[model samples]
Target: MLCENCGKNEAAIHLTQIQNNEMTTRHLCEVCAEGMGLSSGSSASAPLADFIAQMGKGMLAETVSQPGTCPACGLSLADFKKTGRLGCPRCWSVFDASLRGLLRKLHGGTQHSGKVYLPPHPSESDRTARIVSLRRSLTRAVESEDFERAAGLRDQIRRLEAGQEA
Candidate 1:
């Protein structure tokens, strides 16, 4: 998948974060990941396993920065590891850094490599893609001082938004 952050390079880093029963996921290319303070010594050609290991180390550092307690339920990392269960839903995040390794070992990988759902049209996401494309083109046009082209793109964006609202 493409990096959602820059929409340029292929995503080299993928993260899935769960907190308060909500899951947030994002994919990032190396460039963007480094910018976000997720710097790694791995190169683009580094093995996936290596990247994951590095990411796990990073996560471990973050969680252990303050304390071992879950902010919500006060479940300590040691306790969670001992019990092999979480005290509450919030424990997932509280122990996220520590669990990446266990999950990698248990599942053989942190990411799923399987079939996925794909809509026949994917209209909404498709529209969003179009808007992003148009916006990029609009930026280029404006940068090049092509007033006519920029105006056309601006109009197209407005029409797309109108359709979306309706």
Candidate 2:
């Protein structure tokens, strides 16, 4: 297939954009795709993972200046964009907004739809880990002033505690 934009080279990129119940498809060569901003820089020819990370960077660039730092590691949003890695466990909450946007852009959806691997019989350790994780999330929610999320986490924690007692 020929490039839809330039009509010169063979199409190497197929992009499907859906907006408001309308779908638009474009087939473009590397050159045209890069020219149209559908691709990244000179490294646009890189693998899909790199391309997706580039897209995430572009999406996060605008929000990097937001004031928030990981309470545990002191990682700022700008630092995450540069390294593409969180400095500490608490960084997730600190950079939640930017990370969600980046995740949605990179994965096309933020929700996890993949199969979860669980042991046939969950051990006591698993329950303990779950409770610990929930407590951390609850703490982060409260610190971030997300009362609604904190409430939900509280309810979940209560349920888990009740289950343990029972």
Candidate 3:
């Protein structure tokens, strides 16, 4: 495909933009796409550089400066930053606001409304056996005083329970 803008260079990028309820699709080569302020790399063009700078500024503005606190254990975002671990499930709820900003930075935005396909239907007995194994692992972790491992097992058990319920 040829670039829509250059009409000479072979297109290597497809960009779609929605404006005023109308969708516009453009096919462009890397150079043309960069010229239109779409590439992530630094551009020599003043307009493209300015647009990228503004986007960076906007992202910086949206970042969470204040630390979040876990409601259950009173653990703070600073705690997670230091240890890279969460206290409990309740930490998710408490840290959600701040985590959303971090997630957006890492993943582009807080939109995970995507599809996930599962097996047609696993046997109930199979799920039950898995839950039992997870419970045993959790018990062992607790007995060994490995709280982190126990927490992971607990979360797995909870997910299994939820899947079974569904």
TM-scores for every candidate against the unseen true structure: 0.30, 0.35, 0.29
User: How accurate locally, in lDDT, is each candidate?
Assistant: 0.73, 0.76, 0.72
**By the TM-score metric, which is better: model 1 or model 3?**
1
Backbone clashes per model, in order?
A: 0, 0, 0
List, residue by residue over 1-166, the lDDT tens digit for candidate 1. 9999999999988878899999999999989999998855543334554544444444443454535688888887656544455678987766665676667665777788978987767777777788889999999999999999999998888878777531
Cα shift from native, residue 129, model 2 (Å): 34
Q: Candidate 2: where are CA atoms >4 Å away?
A: 1-53, 61-65, 115-166
**Best by the lDDT measure:** 2
Cα error of candidate 2 at position 46, Å: 14
Q: Please give, for residues 101-139, the per-residue lDDT of candidate 3 as tens digits.
A: 656765688998667977555677788889998899899
Candidate 2 lDDT over residue span 1-166, tens digit each: 9998889899999999999999999988988887877764444434654554466568655575555778788887656655566777877777777777888876778898887887656666666778899999999999999999999988888887777531
Q: Which has the greatest TM-score? A: 2
Candidate 3: stretches off by over 4 Å: 1-68, 118-166
Candidate 2 residue 72 C-alpha distance from true site, Å: 1.6
